[model samples]
Target: MTIRVTQPGLSTTVQDLGRPGYFHLGIPISGGMDRFALRAANLLVGNDEGAAVLEAVFMGPALEFTVDAIVAVTGAEMTPKVDDQLRETWTSFAVKAGQILSFEILKSGARAYIAIAGGIDVPMALGSRSTYSLGGLGGHEGRALVVDDELSLGQAGLGAKSGIHIAPKLRRSPGNPAELRMLPGLYWHRVTDVSGRNFFDDTWQVAPEADRIGYRFRGGRKLEFVDREQPFGAGSDPSNIVDGCYPYGSVQVPGGTEPIVLHRDAVSGGGYFMLGTVISADMDLIGQLQPHTATRFIEVTLEGAMKARRGRQNLLDELRASLD
Candidate 1:
């Protein structure tokens, strides 16, 4: 089966759970920004949770399927339509050969995942079908889909059936002034006590520069740092450190003005000092936020973070069981 793109949306790309273990070599784990949404979409279509799917950002693409297939759209509130007939988001439905699939304007959220039964059949690069556009690796031609691009679909499994839907209660979305739990890291000491308190107390708005690489926030008070002599290898700027590895979800405040939370496609290392990292459990929430959305950084302890991680895993377990 094949899907022909008649109109590529703002930025549509193929993604899976991502390719890990290559970041140390400078290859980021580029995958669906809202992983929970991606997993839900895939499961609804009877594909592996990590199966490659079309991740459309802000806008949705217009695709014409060449064969009958079970399909699901999750994550963003962008409504899907099959030949002008409206379909519910987060629910699996049927699309026959020659039926055109498109989406309505986004009502909320930032990105959406479209999962077909059996997944997108792109060749794996580094054991992943994810598209790392910056490096021109994986996915179709190592880049975003364009008009006339044809995507092959893997063989559909019997488990794929229309009408499978995730419950509204199970669906995840960003909260108003989304609360992102953060664990202070090695460079937390660099921020003064006042600035550190203010960081959490103040509300920050998502900046226009948000993307898969990282999310920048504005409208927060500038972070103040302690006065100190610059280290020999480090740059004069207080925010600069003698280059070190950047952990996924690291919140780097350059010039101590704006906090940027690095996400799926961010660089592995950088010179900027990080105040802390948004915990893994809260990272998915960041992906759903649209630019200008209000957010707050909530401090969390190591134990607390672990507890939250376990809770997240438990939710996924529940989702699978519910589907079964």
Candidate 2:
């Protein structure tokens, strides 16, 4: 079966867990911004947690299903509708063979996930089906959904059923002022004594420049750096370091202003000094942020980060069990 796009909403693309183990080659891991929501949506539709689904930004696509299918909408609270009939998000809904699925105005959050009964059958690149648009790498032709695009459907999971819903508490809310956890990075010492403390001392707002590659934040005190002789290859700016690999979720500030958190589609390495990195477990919160949304980064120990990671895995396990 296939689904045809009548109106492709802003930045809709096919994504799974994204390609890993390729950052060293300058390839980004461009998966869904909110993995938790993606997993939830997939589970609701009885698809594998890593199945490729539609990752829509702000708005969603209008799709005409060629065959009756069970689907779910998760992540952002964009109002989803089937042939103009309002449909509840975070729950599975059935669509008739000719029914049209469309999304209206955004109610909250910056992105949303749409999972079909079976995953959107796209060719995998580098062991994943996620789209890295910048490099024109994966997904449906490595680009956002466009009008007239027809996507094939994989075999539906045996458990694919309509009307399944995830609990409110289990859903990732797009509420403003989200608290994200971070761990100090390699160049943290360069700013520690000067203004590193201020990075956490003030609340930050997501900037308009935020995207899949990274999120730039505003409303924080100007970050200052400790005075020191510049390294040979480091740039003149205090915020510049010798170009080096940046871990996923690394936070870097250029010219000591506007802290930027690197995301799934971010470049592998750069010369900018990294102050800290958002913990792996809290990265999803970054994906849900809208422009002007407030955010706070709480510092955490390595052990605390590990604990949070374990907790997230356990929560996924529990969610799967409950759904099963």
Candidate 3:
């Protein structure tokens, strides 16, 4: 199968779920920027939810397929077109062998997800197929995709049937706003009552300084930092206090200025007092934020967080149960 990239848009790369279990060594979980949409698109194409998919940020590359393939688009919706005809997102389609697929400028969120029946074939580094650009690890030479890159699918194929298509309900819609749901962080006590109130009351716009590493939000009320700052423990906060891990959700208020909520690719542990964590369920939402787009962070109690986790676990259980 020949897949050639004639134009690799503003920024495009291959990403799977993420690289986990290495935070202790200060490795960030660099994977699909928008996990939900990517996983959903992969699922629709009969590929595992965590399969490698193409991540298009702000724009996308033009692809020329040499052989037949089934594909789906998700996440921040960019009007993707095949040979200049406007196409849709989230729904799987059978593309003929010589068709050229291209994505225009962003019509909605920041990143777009493209998944095919077979996962993107790439050599795994440290048990993941993600691109860690900073460390020069996995992905296409540990960097973003440019024009003329060739991609081939994995051997784990889902046989494509004739005329199979998905419904509109399964496709991701464009221009949908994403909110970051979160729980109080370890330094929740350090925030003043008034600042805390403003944090939950107002919405912040995505700052220009955002990427696979983290989404930095601005325009919210300037938070007052406390004189008391403490260290974060290792083994998933609130546990034994070891050297903090590298990347995680940390609402860092540096210089007593606006908070920057770090996401998956964030440093494992941090010294900046954490206001709260965005939580796993909403990380995808955080990742899809467009610069200047509005977002609100809701503060939940520890009990509420546990409930949310359990609820999400139940949903996953049901999904897995269906397969069983």
State the displacement of the C-alpha of residue 211, model 2, in Å, after optimal TM-score superposition. 0.6
lDDT winner between 2 and 3, please give it. Answer: 2
lDDT of 2: 0.90
- For model 2, the superposed segments whose C-alpha errors exceed 4 Å read 192-194
After superposition on all CA atoms, what RMSD does each candidate show versus the true structure?
0.6, 1.1, 4.5
Top lDDT prediction, candidate number? 1
- Deviation (Å) of 99 in candidate 2: 1.0
lDDT of 3 by residue, 231-304 (tens): 54433223223444333766666654666777656676654556778776666667677888877888777677
lDDT measured at residue 139 in model 2 versus the true structure, 0 to 100: 93
In terms of TM-score, which candidate is strongest?
1
lDDT tens readout by residue for model 2, 106-211: 9888889999998999998999999999999899998998999999999997888889988886776644578889999778888856477788889999999899
Rank the candidate models, highest TM-score first: 1, 2, 3
Model 1: how far is 258 from its true place, Å?
A: 0.8
Ranking 2 against 3 by TM-score, winner:
2
Off by over 4 Å in 1: none
Estimate the TM-score for candidate 2. 0.98
